[model samples]
Target: MSQPRAGHAPVRPRAPVIRRAAGSRAVALGVCASEPSHEAGAAAVARRLALPLLTSGTDPRHCTRLDALLCLDGDDLSLRQTGRRAPGPVRVDFGAAAMRHRRAGGHNELLGRAVGVGKKTPLVVLDATAGLGRDACVLADLGCRVTLCEREPVIAELLQAGLTAAARRGDPWLDALLSRMRFYPGDARSPRVHSDPAADVIYLDPMFEPRDKYAAVKKDMALLQRLLENSPVQSDAGQLLDWALQQPVARVVVKRPIRALSLGERTPSHSIAGRAVRYDVHVLRSLN
Candidate 1:
């Protein structure tokens, strides 16, 4: 919304490119026609993703060769694997995570510590890679004003839909929490993002190559990894980190697997480790 800072050009949204697994058939976007309420949504998604709508009565089970199905079921937009037991839709849930954070005393956890939550005043966080918005929700629940940036069009749509659904639930706490959050549909690396003065901390969670193939993988994560497999930006951690460093934020926090390699060549100012993940904190200026 603000003018791009001098020498920084506004970045435009790139056309969506649908990638499927090798040997997989073309995927389709469709609505369950029986659910007329979803028709408009499905049509819009089909146009955005550049996919054909599935004909009514075509059994989803028979589309085995198809890579995936972008389905608008009621108000939820989900990418489901055709012919497989539908992995649950990726949804944002602040309630459970918020409860856990509250039980532990919000912002006392490793993630909060890594984000400099207790310093000076209530922090404003830019969740630069808001994949499903789980971490963003936790931060908002902890009282930070969080802005989410999700570049991938499909994933952004899913997040928007999920957040809309959550708001409609009319739960007072959830409504108030949602009010503190905002969405920006653009790449975090875009100069437009760095020009924003609101973010006190920039959080990066670039998708990393999976090291575990067995029981550790959850269905939702597996689906997300599959979708992001061919994305050039998703695989380039160095570039993402470099962009974060250039921002004027007070700190940058990157989430990585506990034993995974550091994101970029620059060493972190400090790191907070948990059982499954680690947060690499890059201090640009002292929050204190």
Candidate 2:
């Protein structure tokens, strides 16, 4: 989740790009790679992404040939398209309005404790499932070094693009913060976060399949829901939980909505609450 980013528009006005090849339904992270009937412009985007052609709608006839669905947000827009929307509580531009929204029966307080802005532990965060790189930025703003990990390369590219653009724009702080963000595609299984990382915390915002069916969960959250639904069942939920648990960090923070079950079966050592969401804070006394 990206926090407090402003002064620039999103990466593009249209749907983000994704790989062209068709991987497993769950493994593909909810993206469908098929040739678009409108191959002209779609091919261009595909060329730029260097991924196999993906069809969001699943039916080439419904979507244009050049209409490539790159699965940047996890869901196949072609399958169930919800166009880009205004940033809600999860948006980086979240200001008084969003804070107010949270204060007015939303999840804000919990966010505060988990992302303690003034903490002194050389705050390093490893966002295991960086859906859109928002949370990592928030932690960085709070004086933490964050390493964002996303199993899908398509989303990673967009994140990298945003960070690079932020860097070039001469936002020195954000640029320096970008230096702190290293994107890795795939999970802990890919040998990305294998070696000991310089992080005091390993954060997990794994996909939350909402059962409440509340559409008011904020656009960013909804977008993430759409994006990650296609993650392979083999997605490393178990391994990630275990590895993070074993990390030499002082804590492992998992972001979840209020009353929601833990990411995996294992419970957190402790928790912090926001209005709409709650952070399961697992304190690692071994490190402490």
Candidate 3:
């Protein structure tokens, strides 16, 4: 196999926050029957998953990171391209077989009959607090064009990595779905809502201030919170809400746990109750 023609940085693993010694080992994909493309892909997968290179084989000293692994048969790490942009050889989709992340089902209670998503509907979703692409993925799967605006580069890289790996595997459903989930890398307290980004609906999933001292956050959530040290802590929810109101969206829906209060002083147009959280829909005509 040959290398791809795109650029997507590797997804740093959440653990082992240290890079291995320079040239710790050599990695190779058999070329006797392997195409040059497979080499590039296998390398890329190692980087995306942050897993050791060729755990099943010896590590090489002269390697440019396996952009992908060529399949001798069916057992190999395929790679995925990140998105539509690239200036050179896109890494072979390596992290193709590793698809562990999935959407959280807790939001269903909040999505009760929310209008705006449907076939061919021009919906621009602003995930003001795109902690991860979980909710964003759900929205994309539901046919809404979602812009995942994330400020932290690390987590942003994770999102890109996950999305890339998904795309690389020729995952028909996920690829088709993520094709519509835009990733806006930066703070969204006041996002650069594209000229037509605002939609009939907007989605906000901000991290709330923990109400109890004894409540222990999940390890993954805690890790993410650590990665996003300066998130909403300095995020001006009121300012964000104000800015969102100026967008072209018709409704702004906020995902809040059952206990969190409504955002800012602005009252919601209405509220929908799910099992554990509330979806506060603030109806707006248009913010063009």
Candidate 4:
């Protein structure tokens, strides 16, 4: 809940223009009226996103011009692709996945090792590119205090909603993990983030052009890529890498696909290579 310092202003990026499909109709955001409890929340979300609330019996299937649909389904809020063949609804579930990863012993995981999680003292990690917050959740579950910075408004909203739901579950262990996590609403490249002295390590996961032609990308990731493609929010790998290297943090970790080149043509001090991805560790200073 700590706010960024006074002099550190947030970078105001251009707002995303919601695109419409071929037809003339506009995309709508709505709740399933059968679940009346979700009406208020849905309405608020629609208002914030500048989307219209679809009326009862509004058949999304027939809305060929609609590009996307944000719906409150029971206890979950989801964004579904309507006009084209989108992978699936984009939502975050931290409870089950976090617990599973923790139970599976993540100390040996490449990310965990790269982030120096098994050290004597708990590390504070700033996940600068916290897409979906999956990695942040895993790091939190492994006893790291994680500050997740998400620049995209829609993705940030979904992450906040997911964390809220996870906290309400009343699971002691989950609550403990959630307590160690924080959300920041600004670009990772913003001065607000770099000026903060709390984090011991900064993590970057810059999105690169998809190289998988023969293999199917995960549904959630595919959906995320599609949404990002249409939004004004973009990741500048070179700039992010440059800023991170100059930070006072003990180390900077960059996640890259195994075969992809290093960000900005700069190599890490060392790297942990996996079958599909690699964690490039840049040691600014020793944590010890």
Q: Which candidate has the highest lDDT of all?
A: 4
Across residues 114-141, which tens digit of lDDT does each residue of candidate 2 receive? 7443465556677887766666666665
lDDT leaderboard ranking: 4, 1, 2, 3
lDDT, model 4: 0.69
lDDT of 4 by residue, 1-288 (tens): 332122212222233236333323333333322255555666566555555566433444454545556666545667676554565677777776544565475323878889998673679999999978888878887788898888876677677777777777888977887888888766876777655547889999877654544234676566566556545544466888898888778999988878777778898999998777888899988886
lDDT of each residue in 9-67, candidate 3, tens digit only: 43332322222223232222221113443434444544543543343332222233432
Better of 2 and 3 by lDDT: 2
Q: Estimate the overall C-alpha local distance difference test score of candidate 3.
A: 0.51
Which runs in model 4 stand beyond 4 Å of their true positions? 1-34, 56-62, 83-86, 97-108, 191-197, 210-216
The most accurate candidate by TM-score is 4
lDDT of each: 0.68, 0.53, 0.51, 0.69
User: What TM-score do all the candidates reach, one by one?
Assistant: 0.80, 0.63, 0.60, 0.81
Compare candidates 2 and 3 on TM-score and give the better one. 2
Superior candidate under TM-score, 1 versus 3:
1
Q: Could you tell me the lDDT of residue 153 within candidate 4?
A: 67
